[model samples]
Every structure is written in structure tokens, then in C-alpha cells.
Target: MSDRIIQSNKEELYASCIKRKMEGWRLAQICAVTINDGFEMSYTFVKDSDMDTLRICLKEDEPISSITQIYPCAFLQENEAAELFGVHIENITMDYKHKLYRIEADTPFKAKEDA
Candidate 1:
């Protein structure tokens, strides 16, 4: 099946996840990549043979609503995004408060300061 991307915004993130869940899709993963302005975040959902992703862009340190309320397991990915890429996720059901990993540098995948 072809993979599709659903561009989403912070305000509609939670609802988007809920819709996917109701459609029998499961949360596959969440990832973040640093951009010139901030970060591009993607939440992947899969069901049967189809894969759809919800993508959003947020400024550094800007908070995005957590989908853990709909998908409790999202806590892990949300935490990873926060600690590894500086994507601020708010209201995680089981927030580790940035202690999910043992990395030394903060937001190592973030954009270079000298860039």
C-alpha cells in the first residue's frame, strides 16, 4: 500500500489521532527532525496494509498537545521527541520529564548553533 501524509496542526493533533484510532489504526511511531525554523514532527499510524502519517511543524520549545490521552503508549515517543529533538510535548499521560534517556547532550539532533 502507498504511504500517505496528513499535514496537521497543534490544535488538531489530538483529534487526528482519535480519528485514526477509531478507524482501527494503531500508532506506529513518532519522530522529529530539526528544520531551519524549528522541527518537523511526524506521527505514523498503520492498519492492515495501509500506513498514514500526521505531520506538523512547530518552533523550538513550542508545546504540542500530547496524544497519550488517546494512545497511552505515546508517552515513550513523546518523551523521546522532547529530550532528543527539543520538541515540547504537553500533557503526556506518563511523562518521564526528560529522563526517558541517558543522553548527555540536550537535543543532540537539533540544528547546529553555528548553522
Candidate 2:
């Protein structure tokens, strides 16, 4: 199946997710990539045989709304993203409070600055 990508801003995240869900897409995965000063979040969804991805770029301090209301299984992915990348995912159905991983340092994926 082919993959389709859609770029979205923070404000449009929730609505875009709702549209996808209404279109019969099932949430597949949520992932984040560390950028210079922020992170790029990708929400992947699958419908029929095709995969659709919604990408949103967010600053370190920016908070993203949880899609758990739309896809109940999203809490796990949101928790991982929050724990590993330090992205603030707001209103998640279940917040693991960074207990998803037992690492010594938080935000392990954050880029280090020469202090």
C-alpha cells in the first residue's frame, strides 16, 4: 500500500485527527523526531490498505493534544513520546508520568548543548 503524508500545525492537530477517524482510518502509530530546537511528531493511520500520516512540528515547550479520545490506544504512544522526547502531550487518557521507561535521565532523545 502507498503512504500519504499531510503536514499540520498544532492548532489543526485535533480536527485533522477527527477527520481521519471519520474517514475510517485507524490510528497506527505516533512517533517523534528530535529537531534542532523542537520535535516533529508523526501520527500514522491505516485504512483499508493505505497508510496516511499527519506530521506536526512543535517546539520543546509546546504542548500537543492527545488523540486518545479519537483512538483509545493512543495513550501508550503519547506516553512514550512524552517520556523519550519530552514533548508535552496534553489531556492524554492515561499519563504514565514518565514512568514508561526507567532511564536515569529524562528527555533522553533531546540534543545536548555544549555548556
> Where does candidate 1 stray beyond 4 Å?
none
lDDT against the true structure, each candidate? 0.89, 0.91
Give the least accurate 10-residue stretch of model 1, judged by summed lDDT. 106-115
Off by over 4 Å in 2: none
Candidate 2: tens digits of C-alpha lDDT, residues 2-102: 89998889898899888988999999999999997899999999999999888999988899889899999999999999999899899999999999988
**TM-score list, all predictions:** 0.92, 0.94
TM-score of candidate 1 relative to the true fold: 0.92
Candidate 2, position 10, lDDT: 83
